[model samples]
Target: MNESKPLVEGAHFPLALSRPDLIPAARYSDPDFFALERDHLWTRTWQMACRLEEIPRVGDWVEYECLGRSVLVARVGEEELRGYHNACRHRGTQLGVGRGHSPNGFTCPFHGWCWNLDGSNRAVFAPEVFDPALLEPEALRLAEVRVETWGGCAWINFDDRAPPLRASLEPFATYHDALGVDRMHAESWFETIVPANWKLVAEAFMEGYHAEQTHPQLLARSAKSGYSAGTDPLGFVDPEDIVGSSLYFMRTLSEGMGGGMVHARDIEVAEELVRMDLPDDPVEALSEWTTRLNDEIRSRASAEGADMPDLNALLSSGHIHSVNFCFPHFWYLPVYGNAASYRIRPISPEETRFEVWTTTLWPAGDQASTPREPTRRPHDDPNWGEVLRQDFANLPRLQRGVRSPGFDAMRLARGVEGTIANFHQALDGFLAEREHADLLPALHGVSGPIDAPIRDLGL
Candidate 1:
């Protein structure tokens, strides 16, 4: 059996030698930088449009708008899904607003020209009113965009030459495949508008370095090694005793920078539900818990005639939370069968539409009967929890602080913030107008290790 490799394992992270240790303050608050991203990055990457369940039925559609560009994804048949630019061929009117069933097709509210679910022209109200050549079916049809579905989500790419989504998301896709995120369903969903640069909001969750300050409650555990210099030591008195406590146990197993553990608020709260009482053997308890949980799920699935993988096998090998940033704007954090996702849409240099989505494996015999529309909430919404709220509040302040005359750049902690630094290197490559094929090498200062697994994975 192949042992699972830790996500942040050494020899996997590359250093861009020429890259500055200090990230420019302007990158976070400069409108010009944001514009460069809109023009070069967002326009060329594969972006998550909607969950497949959101448009499960034929004719059901969802519209995704980002960086002043809008796309419409629709299901045209039981297995057919397609995407198009969300504008009418006629007077440049929008074909769909938000989301709904348009079984017959989309009709332009402005001119009544209609488009079929396949984006083909169905009828033009006044065809003779224009030249015959201009009224050709191809000319009148909605401009089609590339769309693909994987892991229960529909992804769209505006660039015609963009590589397949799976290729762009390699090794991470391997993790998502094992967890079967495609089989999971949304448990709760919401988006919050944060008054901060998108990059500022994204970088906040990329590392656990901030837990000692941003989320002090997480390290409030009585465990001695709960908090280290700036990172969590994750050293418990009894390794076996750690299994029962939520944060302590999971943090014990969820490896991060320098082989130390990292803690996030969701993981902290999740740990609370499990018994924290002392165990005879912490390691054995964790092993048993994983075995029993996997068995229970398998049994339930069999009884319900549903299908589920034996994730215990996968988890045992090395199932740390996988943090994957699908470049330009999407971030996915998948742990076991549950995931929390973030999508950052830039409205301007200082404003962004930050979306947070959570999904978990659906229990056998239970499924939502209706599609869910995302709920928009303020940063302080009680539903987001105190820890999450704390992170949200810190972001805007960070944005403001970066703008201070005294602040020139950011000093990144390479061990803890390697991923963030790698991201900036990738961003610089894009801003320099390099192709994706050549861009990733910038992560290694020039070219990364030829056999480096993460070199192509785009971390």
Candidate 2:
């Protein structure tokens, strides 16, 4: 956080890349692609590690799981952050567990191989047992990993000459910076052991085409009020209309949901009731009629003899999730205009963990105060939690479907398929370059070293 120092870069570099959209059907279940990604892709990239609040003091540290490797990030000094292999510098034993402060630097319980927060080798137990010259600081500091911070988050990379974070994030930096999100303390996070590859889960959120059938609660109650998602240039929009279009309907929920949501007019009354409760006039403030709209979708589905999924309970329970997939795994779902942050990390090809936190920025005065025990969600509230039991419950089953011998491929929507295509392309690019080393020199448009930005921090 010291402004005067040279901005830091991660410790690694890119080894390869793939064309974003043209992944083979076999990659999903192929053990070969899985192994390559674990080694070349995940290991080399600078990844979002942990939120700033997770470690707020000197010697603070947290363990992160990436691919199959376990790593640790530590706050060793007032402004300097360090990363280690999470293994003892001595006999390669695992270091600290969970998250907490380590004021005395890191001392391995096994054989007392100690590390300074700055990652220098401070001491070794039983000095007489080892040669004095070899154990000195120059020779024995714990191996350092690369680290950086943006938007109050710290990221780390394991490569020694890794590309700069800013460069890799260049295309999306403006949007990333515009997110006025600080770290949020998650109230609850739901984890489902999906049977599908990590890519499948990412694809599910990348596009909204599946909402009509997969998310009746979201589509029926909130789709009309501009049910939309911001897309990267990679977004796939189906050109064909009515028969099958891929555009996500720009949407938001009317700031309320309840039994009254069964009808559209009642939702309007509820919004009025909410507006009256607030001190400011709701007419001028940014607002929408999401909660005020409803289609007789359930009855229509029934009349058309559609075998409704068991999601009637969730739709009737009046819960709506305004989730934004912040490209890759950052699912930004805020609630009631409060603060929340969600990130999913891949543990392996088929398993990923979700980290959800609810936090609101207190803009330093009475105006920034957030309501405690929030009970409702606005479509635009980025701080809301994605209980997501309804969303993630079927993933494992879907994963299993991909594994079925009879199923080789599934269709994607045209208008809404952009993210899905982009994700596949990104994944393919990552996997392709990793496997084919010769392609590196030919990567014309995107390959460049980005230096850490040197900016005035107003010292």
Candidate 3:
């Protein structure tokens, strides 16, 4: 989701057409490019849906939409979280509005054709006229799609035969046990109606390249230390020990949980540095620290007119945020070491909606360490609210710049560009494989930023 442009501000324009394979600004301004992404990339990809805990009981349901289709997720029991088309069988109206609880079945508001939790038609509006097909369970039944869950998340595909979620997430399962996704609960969530594509949203998280430039609040501390983030030969999010004294909080977590000798490993190190004061059990240390930091920001944000407490509580649980960038489009950012969360949304052309699903380690029937208190909802958070406001202010501007005939391409620095490139590598892979993605031709000639390996001290 993170990106760089072909030009800069109030300065001499340096046309860095380094990556010749990619069309300079196709992702930003091209409607055809967006169409291809919608048709091939999103529809074919397995997406992060609700966490298994969201609908713990039979008949619980959640809604999902991608590729212009609204998907309804329902749980018939503890084990099943299934997807439907979200349309009522009778009137063709959306079965559910925003999001609410449906105890045992979803009765359409249109004509009252009720569907069981298993997606079967339990009661048809008019059962007699087409009685032959009406009585034939399948005819009146809601259309079912594919569902799968992993790393404490639920995923669904409209194509029943799409590869299982596990197959798509290769070599990632080994680290799943550390995520503790199932033990988490929601802390807080807020949405930004961004005027850019979903890729713009992702670009923010893709790398630390823009940290100093885009995130001044975080840079106040991050700029002070030993951080040199870049890409490895394989294009991973590489965070090495920082060069100087200033460092960010995430370094602690990264160093603590690091096992992979890949790019994102640096983030693990950064997080570990952040949690330096945490307990011996890095997980416990991570959880405690997250709750404290998240709460502080929430309190300050609310005081400023931008705090959303209920959402903050969901985020501060310490269980979510441990896992960052869990997949291509979603970020399982466990701000605390103890928990993890799911941040995902499809880029519908120039518009995108971000869904932040939070969770704690505690499952149904399990006791949570944090006392169960009345959850309060709020309108905004000032401290963190300003943070996002800043992003929203800038991203759309970046999206706008891609359209100018003056700009050509971007030039990424070695250390600061890793996260951005890692994301692009993933996107490139998807585009190359997609039949609709003829966009690969635009990015073919971009040269490598770093050679095979750039290690300090040559371990």
Pick the TM-score winner: 1
Flag clash pairs in model 1.
Answer: 16-445, 240-282, 246-271
TM-score of each: 0.81, 0.64, 0.63
TM-score of 1: 0.81
lDDT by residue (278-344, candidate 1, tens digit) is 3455455545545554565455544655455676777666654555665556656765455666677
Where is the poorest 10-residue window by lDDT in model 1? 446-455
Off by over 4 Å in 3: 1-23, 131-135, 216-323, 339-342, 346-348, 357-389, 413-459
Better of 1 and 2 by TM-score: 1
lDDT of each: 0.65, 0.49, 0.50
Best by lDDT: 1
Predictions ranked by lDDT, top down? 1, 3, 2
lDDT of 2 at 120: 77
* TM-score winner, 2 or 3: 2
